[model samples]
Target: MKKYVQEATDINVWTSLKEDTFDRGKDIREFIEGLELIEGNAFISLDAKWGDGKTFFVRQIEETLKYFRAKQMETEEKLLKDLESYEYLKESVAVKETTVEHIYLPVYYNAWMYDDHNDPLMSLLLVMTKQCGGAYNTKINTKSLGERLLAVASSLPISIKKINPATIIKDLQEGKMDILSAVKTEEDIKECVRDVFNDIIVEEAEKLVVFIDELDRCKPSFAIEMLERIKHYFDDERIIFVVSLNKEQLIHTISNYYGSEFDATRYLNRFFDVSINLPEISWYQKQKVQCTNSERFWITLIADELSDYYGFSLRDKLIYKSSIESLPRDVGDAFSQDKMYLNIFEVIIVLLDMVDAKEKKAFLEGKSNILIDLMPRIEIYKKYILRSFGIDIRDDCEEKLTEKYKLVQEVYEYVFGRDTEEYFKEADISRNLKEICIKACNGLKS
Candidate 1:
C-alpha cells in the first residue's frame, strides 16, 4: 500500500503564502478588506493575460477571506458564551445579537471549467446551492435551493434522467452533474432563482463572496452570459463577486458579440466596481538578491542577450522561457552549453508563433542532429523573422546569433570529435532540467 503526501510548494493557493517578490496577492487582499469594510454588493475584476496565474491569485484572496471569517466567527461565539455565562451568574436574562461584522461565505466557481454547460446562471446556482449547505449555519436551508435547482434543470429541454433530488444535490456539489439549458423565456426563472439565492444568502451569512475565475477562457457567449446573469439575477446588496479574466480578451469577446463597432470598453465599464491589473513580475527586487536556477540562467542569458532589441519584459521573457522549457525529454541534456542554450532559445522564439505543439516537440527531440538541422534556420530567424519584427539580433559581437551557433557547434565538435553528431545522438543529459530553468527564471533577469 502506498500513501501520498502533499508537497509544500505545490501551487496550492490555500497553503501558499503571498510571494513577497510580487505585490499582486497583497493588493488583492487590500481590495477584499476594503470591500469588507463597506456594505452592499460589489463586483471586482482581477485582470491579467492568460496563463498569468489569475486563478492562483484569486484562490489566495478566497483563502484570506475565509481566514478572516473564521477568526471573526470564533470571536463572536466566545462573546456569546461569555454573555450567557454573565447572565446566568447575575440571575438576570438578557438578549443580544451574536452576529459578527463582515462574516462571509465564499463560493469559488471556475467559469471556464464549466464551458460545456449552456447556462451560466445554472452553473452559479448549482454552486451556490451546494455551498449554502457547507460549514456555515445549518439553519440556512440550502436543501430547498438544491431541490429548486433540480426542478428547474429538469424542466429544461434536455433529456435528463429521473435523478433523485437527494442524489442531484450530492452530485451537484461534487461537480458530477451539470445544469444545462434554461427554459425558454428565462425572465421568470431568473427572478425566481434570484429571489431564492438572495434569501438563502441573507439568511445564511453576512455576505456571499463569489469568486468567478477563468472567464477569459470560457466561450465568448458563456462569458457574456455569466456577466449578464450576475448583473441581472445575483445583484443582491450582500453579495460580492470577484471575477478573474484578461480584460483585453473580454473586450474582444464583447466586440465579437455586439459587433466590432460597439464601444466595448465603455460597455464593460458598467460591470465592474473595481478593476485590478496584476503587475508584471519584476526582473529584480529591491534589497533582495533573486535566486536563479541553472535552467533559468540559460533562458535568461539568451533573453538578456536579446532584450536590447526584443524589448521583452520580465513577463514576456518568462513566457518565452516557458516555451523552451517545455521541450521534450529526448533532447533534455543536449542544451547545457551556454551557447547552445542561447542558440536553441533564439530559434524557438522565432519559430514559436509557427510550430504547433507536436511539431515543436518533434523538432526539439529529434536526435543529435537537432542543433545541426536547425543551423539552416538560424539565418532565416535572424534575417527575415527578427528584422520583420524590427529586431536585429546581431547588434554587437556579444549579441551575435552566428557567434552563439558557432560556439554550440564547437562544443559538439570538441566533445564528440569525428562522431560529434553521433555523440549528441547518444548523449543522455537528464537531471531535472525543467526545475533548473524555473529556478533560474525565478531569479533576477540578468
Candidate 2:
C-alpha cells in the first residue's frame, strides 16, 4: 500500500550516507567539501530528471553541510561542549571525521509549497529567517526585518492595506513634502533586502546555502519570479543558492509562460552560475555483486533488470518494486521456489499492464515479438535458469542454451498465446503451473 517513496529525514540521510546504500555517498561528501573553494555569491543548479532522487541528494548535501558547520564550531572548546548536548550531531560519522572544511548555514525551501504566496522573495526571506535562526540559535531582529519589508512595500507602486498613495500625492502637491525624496529607487529596494539577508548571515555562519527544491513543479510565473528575485536581490558575497529541478520540465514551464519561440535555455542561463547533473545509479553493477538468497533480493534484481530493459527512471523502478511487493505471500514464495520462470512472466505481465496496457494486450493477443525479442537479450532469466538447473554457462555449449531458451519460448506461447486454452490442453506443461500463473495475474490485477 506504500504509494510514494519516503522523503529523506535527517536519520535517513545520515544512515544512507553511512552505509553508502546507493553507492554515491563518498562523491556527495566530496562535492560538499569542494564548496569551500567558492569565493562569492553563487547560483548552482543541480539538474536531474523528475523522480531521479534530486530531493534526497540535495537533502544529503544540506545535512552534510550542517555537519561541517557543527564541526567548524567544535574548534572552540565551549562550542564543542555545547554541541555534545545535540544527540543527532553525535550520530553523524561525517561530523566526527570533519570531512568538510567549510561551514555554511543551509536552508531548504520547497518552492512548490510556497508558490501560493504573494511574493517569492518574501516567502524565501521568512524561510531563511526561521531555518537559520532556529539552527544556529541566533536571535534575529524580527522587528527590524519587518520594518525593512514594510519600507520596501511602502515605496512600491503596489497597494498595501490602508496606505493611500493619493494622500502622499496631495501632500506633495500642497508643498508639504517632496515625493521624490520619499520614493526609493530599484537599487535602494535591492540594497534594503540585501542588508536584511546580510543581517541573518553575519551572526550565524560565514555563508548561507539556500537549497531550493521543486522549482520546476511550481507555477511557471512563480518559478521565474523566484529566479529573478534571487538574481536581483541576493547578489551578495556570503550567499549561495542551490536550485534543484528538471531542466527540461522547467524549459517547458518557461515556454508555457513566455511564447514557445522564446529562448528559455538562454534565459535560464542567466540565473545559474554553475550546473551539475545528478550521478546515475549503478544498478547492474550493484546487482552483480549482491550475494543474497532472500525473496526481496530476487525481486529487486528482477525489477532492476526490467527497469534497464524498459529504460525506467528511478521513480519507475520504485513503483515497479512496490507493485511486486504488493503481491500475495505465496506469489512471492513461488518466485523463490520451483517454476520461477513462470512466476517471473506473471510479474512481467502485471508490469506491462501497469506501464503499458496496450502492449500487454498485444502481448496477450499472441503478438509476443516484443517479449520474445527480450528473452535472448535479458541476462536475469539466463542466470536464473543456470542457477535453478545446476548448469554453469562457462562449461555449457551454445546449442544447449539455445534449446533452453526454445523451451522457455514454447511455454510462453502455450500460456499467453491467443486461444491459450487450446495450447494449454496440448502442451505437456503441468496444470499446476498454468493455474499458478493465472491466479497470480488475476491477483495482481485485483
Candidate 3:
C-alpha cells in the first residue's frame, strides 16, 4: 500500500499515488544517510508545490523512522503484558523482542498550530513522548521551563488557546514533574522547547524529527509565528524540522513579518543549512490527448494553447488547436466556404490561456458545429490567415501573415538560436493576432 493519504485528519486509511515513481533516487538516498546521523537537525525542503506529492514523501520518511524505533525496543517476550502499558518506561527496562530490521514511528506536528504564537511547548512534548511509546504521565520535571505560560492557557488571546510551554518540556525530561501552569518569559519558552528535543535524543536515544506541513496555507500572521518559532526555538542538534511552503506566499508572509526588513534569503539562512527549490513542471512534459484513425494526438500541446508564451508543452498546443479544429461538420452537407471560415474565425480571437486545448476545441466545435469544413481541402491556409489575422489582403493573405510570423520567427531564432518559445513572444503574437482577427472578420471585410 502507498504510505500516505490525501486527507488531513485521518491517519488510518492510505491512498496510492502516482508520484511515488518519480526518479529522485540519489537525493532520497542522501536524505536517508542524513537521518542515520544521531546529532544535529537537518533542515531539508521537499521542493514541490502544494499538490505535487509533499504528503506522500513525508509519510514515507515517517514509516522509515517508525521501523527503526520499533527494532530498537526489547524483545516481545520481555514486553510482558504487565510492563507493556506504562507512560514513560525507563530505558533500564529493556524489551526481549528478536532483532527487527527497523522501526516506523514518526511524530507528526500539525501545521495549523503555527498560528497561535502562544502555543504551549508542553503539547508538542506530549506528542514526541507518545511517539516513543511513552505516555505523558506525571513523572517529568518542568519548573526549569517556568510558570507564567500556565496562565496564558487558562485565558486565551483572540480566542486562541495558549498552552504552558514548560509543562510539556518538563514532562518529556523528568517524566515525573506535574506542573500545570505556564511561564511568560521568552527565555523560559525557548528553554522548554529546546529541552524537549534534547531530552528525546539524550534520554530516549531515539532519532528526533519534526514534520511541519502546509506553511503556505496559514494566514500571514500565523505563518510568521511559525517561521520565528523554528528560527529561535527548534534549532536543536537532535531535532529536524521539515516544513512545506510556497515561495510567493512565503515572501508575502515574511514581508509582512519583517516589514521593511524583508530579505527572503536572510530569514531562510538563519536555520536552513541547505535549501532547495521545487521546480514547476516544464513545457516539454508530454501527455496523451486523443486518438484518431490515422494517428494519435500524442504530443505536448503547450505551444498551441498559449498565444504569447516563449514556449509551451505539446499538450498546450494541441489543446488550443482543438478550440478551432473540434468543430463538427454542419449537418446535411452544407459545406459553404463562408460558413467554414466563419467557424475557424470563432476560435482565433480572445486567446484564453487557462483552459486546455481539448476543452477549447470542445467548446468551439460544440458551439459552431462545422465538421465538413475540415474535410474539404479548399485553401484552408488562406482561410486560416484571414480569420486569424485582422487584415484585408487579396487572395494571398497567408503569404502576408506567414511572412509576418516568419519575421517574428527570425528575431526569436536570433535571440534563442531557434524557435525555442514557439509562437509565443510579442513579435509572433502580433502576426497571429492579426491573422485570427482577419479570419474572424472574413478577410477583414466582415
| Top-scoring candidate (TM-score) | 2
Q: Which ranking of candidates, highest lDDT first?
A: 2, 1, 3
> Could you tell which candidate, 1 or 2, scores higher by lDDT?
2
Model 3: per-residue Cα lDDT over 95-204, one tens digit each = 11112232323567656553343433444555555454442222233442233334333333323234455544554344343232334566666665655454445443
TM values, all candidates = 0.60, 0.74, 0.48
For candidate 2, the per-residue lDDT at 338 reads: 28
Query: By how many angstroms RMSD does model 1 differ from the true structure?
Result: 11.2
RMSD of each candidate relative to the true structure: 11.2, 7.3, 13.8
Q: What is the lDDT of candidate 2?
A: 0.69
Q: Which stretches of candidate 3 lie over 4 Å from their true place?
A: 1-20, 24-26, 71-105, 113-184, 194-205, 278-446
Q: Could you tell me which 10 consecutive residues in candidate 3 have the lowest summed lDDT?
A: 291-300
Best candidate, lDDT-wise? Answer: 2
Pairs clashing in candidate 1? 293-439, 293-440, 295-436, 295-437, 296-437, 296-441
Q: Using alpha carbons, what is the TM-score of model 1?
A: 0.60
Residue-wise C-alpha lDDT for candidate 2, range 1-446, written one tens digit per residue: 45545667767766655655565665575567657778999999999998778988888778778766776666656555665333554454444444655568889999998887667876787778767767776656555555555565555454545545455434333445332233468776677667677668755387889999999999988999999988988888888899999999999999889998999999998899988888877876334323232665554566567776777666666666666666544643343332455546766776797688888887666466555567578887677667655677789455666676666666676656646345354334553454576666665431
Q: Which ten residues in a row have the lowest lDDT in candidate 1?
A: 89-98
